[model samples]
Target: MTSGLQQKNSILILDFGSQYTQLIARRVRENKVYSTIVSHKITAEEIKKQAPKGLIFSGGPASVYDEKSPKCDKGIFKLGIPILGICYGQQLIAQYFGGKVRRTREREFGRQELFIDDHADFFSGLPGNITCWMSHGDYVSSLPKGFVSIAHTLSTPNAAFASRDRKVFGVQFHPEVVHTARGSEIISNFLYRICRCRPSWEMGAFIKDTVSHIRQLVGKDSVVCGLSGGVDSSVAAVLIHRAIGRQLRCIFVDNGLVRNREPEEIKTIFRANLHMNLDFVNAQNRFLKRLKGVTDPEVKRKTIGDEFIKVFEEEAKKIRRVKYLAQGTLYPDVIESVSATGSPSAKIKTHHNVGGLPEKMNLKLIEPLRELFKDEVRELAKQLGLPQEIIHRQPFPGPGLAIRIVGEVTPERLQVLRDADDIFVGEIRKAGLYNEVWQSFCVLLCIKSVGVMGDERTYENVIALRCVSSSDGMTADWVKLEPALLGKVSSRIINEVKGVNRVVYDISSKPPSTIEWE
Candidate 1:
C-alpha cells in the first residue's frame, strides 16, 4: 500500500531520459502539489488509472527525428488533461501535431530573451520579453493547426506554444531551471491556471500520514534502522520510533569508511543524548577485507552493500523478534540507482542502500522517506523537532570515503584522505562557511605529484577539494570560496595530512562532473 502521495491533486511526469526530469518534479512539489515520475513508454490506459491532474513531459538529450529516440504513447493526449512539454519534449509535441521540427544551424545552449506575443492564456501576466534558459538544436519551423506561438526567441521562432482549446502546451526553453528568469512563475501559472491543482501538500501532513502508515505496516514486529547519523537516517529513525516506540532499534556501523571520529560522534548524538535503543557494531575489518583491491565504483558499492546486508543480517538475528529493516533511502538514491522501464535515463551511480534491492534477507524493507528529496528530508527533520546540528549536517554518501578515494580501499589511503578531509571541513567550519555550501570534502586523486618539502623534491598524493552550492542535489554549481580560505586549507592539509603534498580545487558543475571523485 502507498502513502497518501498518489492523490487527485498530484501531477505525473513522463520521464524521457532527461537529466533534469527530477528537477521538474521538485518544482511541482515546491508548488505544494505532489508529482511522480514514470517511464514515457507507459500507455494511455495506464495513465488513466493513476488519474493525474496534469501531465508533464520532461526534456531529454535525444531528438524526435532520430530513428530510435524515446517517445510516449500518442493516445495520452486524448485524456483531455492539461499537458506541458519542455525542450526535446516540445519537439515530440510539434512532430505529433502536424508541425515541422528541423535541425538548426547552431544550438542555443544558454539564457536567451523570449518575446511574448500574447500574455492572455498561457503566458499570462508576463511582460514583453523575458530571459529563458534554452538548450536545444531543433526548432519548430511551423506551428500545429490549432497551436499558436505565445513566445519566441531570436534563434527559436516558436519558443513557447499553446493550444487553449485542447488544453495542451509546449515550451522550447526549460522553466524548471533557475537560469530562466521568473521560471517558477511560469510553472505556477501552468499548475494553477491550466491544471487547477490545489496547493495542499506539506511536510506536516506527510509526517502525520507516514507515522500512521508505518504503524499499520509494522504492527508488532520489531524494526531495525541502519543509522548513519545523517539527516535522512535521523528523520527516518525518529518517524519510525514515533510509530513503534521501543520496538525500533538503531544500529550504527563503524565500517572504517566514514569521516574521522564520525562513528563516535554519531554514538554521542544518538545513544547518549536521544536515548533510543541503539547498537554499535565495529565491522571495519569485515568491510575492508571485502573492499580490498576493488577499483571500479560499482563493484565497490555493490561489495559494500553486500557486506552491510551480511552484518545487518547477523545483528538482526541477535535482536529477537525483529522482522523489518529500515534505512534512510531518499528519492535521488532511487532515481540515480535504478533506470525506468523502456526509458533512456542512464544510471549515474549505485548507492549502497538502494543499489542492492533486498536479497537473501529474512526481514522486509521499510523506507519512509524514499519519495522525498534531500531538502524535503531536512524540512521533515525540523518538523520532528530534531536539533539544528542534525538537520543542517551536510550530506554523506552511504559508501562513505571509499567513493571519495579514486582507487583501491586500503587503511593507508583511507587515513590520508581522512586527514586531508578533516582539515578541509575544519577550515570551512571555522570560517563560518560550513553551512553555506551543499557539500564540501577532500578527494584523494589516484595520481601523485612531485613537490619540494624542506629543500628536497618528493612525490606525494594530491588532494582535490570539491565544494558546491545547490538548493537540491539534482543540479549543482561549484561554490566560489574565498582565496584566503582556500590558501589556508591548502597549507593546513599539506602540513598536517601525511603523504599529501598538494591540494587542488575542483570547479566543475554537475552536468560535466559529479560531486564525488569516484
Candidate 2:
C-alpha cells in the first residue's frame, strides 16, 4: 500500500536504524490500528501532515553522542501527540529534554528484570516487576526536566520515565520484542489507553479498500501478475482477480531452479483448484544458460530476476493490452531493500522481487501486499477463500532454488538440492514440524569432502540444513529439531539424495546471519 492510503488515526514510528524497528511497527499494527514507519529525520511539518495520533521512536545501534547519530526534529515534541521512546529513542528524549545520558559501565542485554516505581498508565494492569528484553549500552543518568522516573532496574535506575501531562513516555527496554513478556500488552496499553486509537483496521477492511483502489486505478486496463505459487503471490493474484476478474492474468515462470516437480504441482493447483486465468512458462533452459558460470550471490540473484522479467515481458506481449505488473512485495522486502524508515539500515541480501526487479519495465507496478507482513498475507489468503495448501505453504524466495544453491546454479546441483530439500520437508511434515517452523530448506554447499561408502573412498558435496522459527521473516532463531528427527533427516538425505555426505544444522540467529545462506 502507498503512503497516501494509510488510515487516519495512525501511529507514526520514527526509525533510527534499529534492527527491531519493523517489529515495533508489527506490534502496533497487530492492535488493529494503522502504523507507518519513517526516518528519524522526518520533519515536524511532515509528521503533522500525516496527522498521526501517536508517535514512537524506535531503538537503534548508534549512540546519541555519536557524531553521525540520527536525531528527530525537536518540534515533534510540540505536536501534542502521545510519544513513546524506546532504547536509543529513550536516550534521544532524555538528551533532548536536558537529561544526562552516558555509556554505562554495566551494559544491559537480553532478558532483565524491571521494577516499577510509581505505577503509571503506561504500565497499567501490569505487575510491579516484569521481565523485559534490553539491548542498550547507554542509560539515562538523570530524568528530563518535567519527567518523573516510573520504573528502574538494578543497572538502569531510570528504566522508564513519563510526563503524563505532556503525554510523553520513555522505556529503556524493548517491549516490541517477544522476549519482553507482556510486550504486546504494553503496546496495547499505549495504543488504546494513551493514544485512544480505535481498533478498526482488519484484513477484511484491507481487502475491500484495496479492491476498490485497484478497480479505480485499473479501470479498463489489463494487469499481469507474477505468480510463484507461494503464499504471497497466490494471495496477490486472488485479490487482484477479485478486483478485476477478466482483466487479471497470472504468469508462473518455471526458471529451472525450483524444487523437484514444483512447476507441475503449481500448474495443477492453479488450473484445477483455484481456476485462475494463468499462463505457465518453462524458461528453465534460458535461466540455466544465463547462469552458466555465475558464482557471485548478488550476480546470480540479478541474473535470475532479469531473466524472470524478460519472460514476463515476452508473455505480456502475447496477452492483449496489459498495462500493469503486480508482485507480492511484502514489508520485509521493502525494509531490507532500502530502509522504508528512510534511516540507514545495512542492506541485507537483495530480494529478487524487491530491488532486483527491473525499474525500466514497460508496465506500471502494483504491489498490494507491500505494506503487509508475511503472517498478514496468510490471513488475507484465508479471507480470499484460498485452499489450505496454498494458505499454509512456507514462503519461497522469488529467485527460487538459485539462491539456495550456494556457489553455482547448475542442473546437477539444482536437482541434488531439490531432491534433498523435498526429503527434508517431507520429513518435517511427517514429524509434524512443517507448520511449526517459519522456513526450512537445505542448501547445497559448493565445497566437497571425502567420505566412505561401502568400505570404499567417495567424495561428494556437503548439504546444510537450515530451519528457523520466527514470527515475521524479519527476525528468526534456529529451530531446535529433536535429535531423532535430525537423525532421520540426515540419514534419509545421505542415503537417498546422491551427491551429499554431510548434514549440518545452522544455529545462527538473524542478527548475525540471514535465513538464506547466499
- Model 1, global lDDT: 0.88
Question: How many angstroms is residue 406 displaced in model 2 relative to the true structure, after the best TM-score fit?
Answer: 1.3
- Summarize candidate 2's per-residue lDDT along 1-518 as a digit string, tens digits: 43334457689999998878888989998998888788899999998888888999999889999989998999999889899999999999999989999998877777899998876578888999999988988999988789999989888898999989989899999999888888899899999989999886788778988999999999999999999989999999999999999899999888888888788888888888878898988888999999999999999888888888899899999888899999999998877776876697777778888878887988889999998999999999989999888888998988888888888788999989999999999999998888889999999888999999899888998999999998998878899989999999999999998988888888998866888888
How accurate locally is residue 298 in candidate 2, as Cα lDDT from 0 to 100?
Answer: 92
Error of 1 at 153 (Å): 1.9
Query: Which residue pairs in candidate 2 collide?
Result: none
Worst 10 residues of 1 by lDDT: 1-10
Residue-by-residue lDDT tens digits, candidate 1, 1-518: 23455487889999898878888888899999888888998899999998888999999878899999998899998999899999888889989999999998997787899899989756788889999988888888899999999999888889999999989999999999877888888888899999999997888888888999999999988999999989999999999999999999999889999998898888888888887898999999999999888899889999988888888989999987999999999877877887643578788888999876456677889999988888899999989888889999999999889999998989999999998988899899998988888999998889999999999998999999999998888778899999999999999999988898999999999766877766
RMSD of every prediction? 1.9, 1.9
**lDDT of model 1 at residue 449?**
97
Instruction: Give the 10-residue window scoring lowest on summed lDDT in candidate 2.
Output: 1-10
